[model samples]
Target: MTTLPDGLHDFLAEAGWAGGTIEPLPGDASFRRYFRLRDGERRAMLMHAPPPHEDPVPFLDVAAWLTANGMRAPAIHHAEPEAGWVLLEDFGDDRMRDWLDARPGDERAAYEAAVDALVQLHRLPPGPFAPYDMDAYLREVRLFTEWYAPAMGLTVDEAGHEAAWREALEPLLARQEPGVTVLRDYHAENIMLLDGRSGGPQGLIDFQDALVGHPAYDLVSLLQDARRDVSAALEAAMLDRYAAATGAQDDFRADYARLGAQRNAKIVGIFTRLAKRDRKPRYLAMIPRVWEAMERDLAHPALAPVARWFDANIPGDVRRAQGGKIA
Candidate 1:
């Protein structure tokens, strides 16, 4: 067993969970780590985010907003922001991925619930999260050149890449409708299915990176997942549902395609960096799926220039030539 940090023990004791047993939970791509705490029949989640690296402020703020808006976010039982320890409500182990794996036939209902949660969230008044504007979008995609390019033993014309991306993406940016709270990572893995929750059936996690952005952004993130395969049929259905529910379906498909490409491009770089720099190669296996999704997004007529750039530089054969291995 991994030894518990002294501070964690102290924090738990201060929070009156002193004798609770700690069991490490599966971690995500971030610096934060989660553990389940059990004291007799009571349970809670402990989030350990080392300071100077990861902060709990955003998670705390977003959780508050989500709960306030009638969505199901984990309640904060105790918080020690300065020490980077937070005790959160245990939403149980019903992550959407695991739930779907166990009941393949229920995929549609699960996705519908997830989409409904988004619809409710979008209805809420916008919060103070940072804008996911063009500058931020461009900044994120640079990871493609910064990490993925270097790992594939290829050189990138950084200036040329950014300029081209700007040209391709600016029009889409200009066409964006008013923004909503975009939970930067709204895919299945971060969503919890609360079987009997009073507010909503879906619970959101991993939203510290939330931003106020184009309403289509989270929808893109949901249907065009990086780590998992979301079928085209389900994706289409969810898009239709969101559009019909929100009445902002005007040019929604175009926005979805544009943002999907941008996001997958960023993921390609991030996953590569995780393997080569962070020494976590498991993320590499998901690259091909992300690349495939990016290709689909680039096929949109609006992305012709971006598509041309990829064709000129990382030809299809060469891009997939890595054969699922980053090293």
Candidate 2:
């Protein structure tokens, strides 16, 4: 089991959260650590990060920016700069996954709420927020070819397949879309359903690392989830729904499908790496779900060529690893 610094208990004692128990929370990619501490309605979170590995500074800066721009983020109360620990406002206990999984009939309604929230988030003006440029995005996408292929003991056909992936992505990059802050992890897990709303306003955890990216990126994140399964018909309907909501051109569906291919490709490599490099095996199970979404998305008209490539080149095993029963 992973752990925080030795003085963590002493530190919590000093924060008036003494009676609260400490339970370590599961993390995805970052080096930061989280703990759920509570005694009652007075719930709060503790974050720990070490230098070079993680830093809460950007999170602080962005949280203020998001607050000013009308988003509900964890309110910071106390902090120790040298120690990398902060006490934050509790968003309470409703993970969107639990809420949606409990009622599949309510899925579309909740997703619609998420789409509306994405609209508001993307609409934010960008003078204060730093640019999430192509360099960072491209660097992120390359993770599949770099970390993924190596972990799988696969060559990745770097000279060939890598090019295909980029060529497939060029149109998406050319789209030149501007959006407000894009919570790169805008999926069910991070979103919280507050009160009676079907997919209540975002509770917003893990957004300190948000990238200033295309609004559609986040929409892809929510609808074409890597972990949970979203039906193809639902994905299509939601794609159209988002377009109608924003009055965007129907071309949005094509762009959405293409982007789905790009994102899922990166994720395939990522899950392999997570297991091989980080020794975190849980991510391996998510491999196929992401692939399934990619396959369904590639069925779109604009992605016909991409579909052809996967059909011909990306092995049957690749698809199987991506989560299809192959019946």
Candidate 3:
């Protein structure tokens, strides 16, 4: 029996869920919290995203758009966005990461379905969302210098870093097509595997920060997951599958690589910030995995400029170290 706020209790009661059991679920990196509610045979998920630090409007809007578009975002049963509480359809506990951990043999099939979902999603025009443009890209990549570099006790060439990222990213941005809806966090953990759904269409979650961006962005997020290992062979095969399906073989690889490097750099900074500023040190352990994925992406020719910047700024020892810890 977890203690909840008076506002949440009133919201649930107004939604006809009074006297239900409230079970708090594990939280994620954001300021949001979730709980499971039960009344008789009924079950619903409660998303408590308090304002000032978090907002539920974007999540509610995106969920509606996805469900309306015939995708698998959790159906919103009830919502009071001003109060930062949303009651949602329960897409039970089978996250893609946990599911794969139990059935390693199902990896390929599961990933194929995931890729197909992305194909379906990319076909839809982007919703009302901000563009993941040059300023956005630069702001995200600078997290490395702003947080991770200082935390690692290393002073880096901030000017060179920006120049390198510009050289690598501008070309990709220049030739961008009509952008697709990019679920900025489309990795395994954020994806759910619903039980008894035929073909196991994934249940999408944690996409409040959706944006209009290159098609390659979400693909990189899925295949180069930070919390888990996606083998090189599987990544290549998936890229091939996406290319074959979409006829985007021309410059997809470069786009994927550049975005991958940028995304991973941002993750490195975020994880460091979480540890340093937010007092959540567990994220520190994931930095090494993120570094490996970033390195793989930086190997692509399109990422040469950024790679050179990293080589000149971040020492090889720090790059290889777990969590980028100096000590």
lDDT of candidate 2 over 1-327, digit per residue (tens): 665577787777888777777778876676788888877767788888767677888777777787888887778888775677888887767778888778778898888887888777767775255555656555665776677655545554554555555565566655544545777778888888766566667777777767665667778888888878888788778777777777877666677776777778778767777677777777777877887777777887777655675666556785666632221
| RMSD (Å) per prediction | 1.9, 3.3, 1.4
lDDT of each: 0.84, 0.72, 0.89
The C-alpha stretches of model 3 lying farther than 4 A from their native spots are 196-199, 322-327
Best by TM-score: 3
Tens digit of per-residue lDDT, candidate 3, span 161-262: 999999999888855557889999998999898873324889999999998889999999999999989999999999998888898866788899999999
lDDT of 1 by residue, 163-193 (tens): 8788877876655445688898998888898
Clashes of 1: 0
Which candidate, 1 or 2, would have the higher lDDT against the true structure? 1
Off by over 4 Å in 1: 174-177, 196-200, 322-325
**Window of ten residues with lowest summed lDDT in model 1:** 318-327
Ranking by TM-score: 3, 1, 2
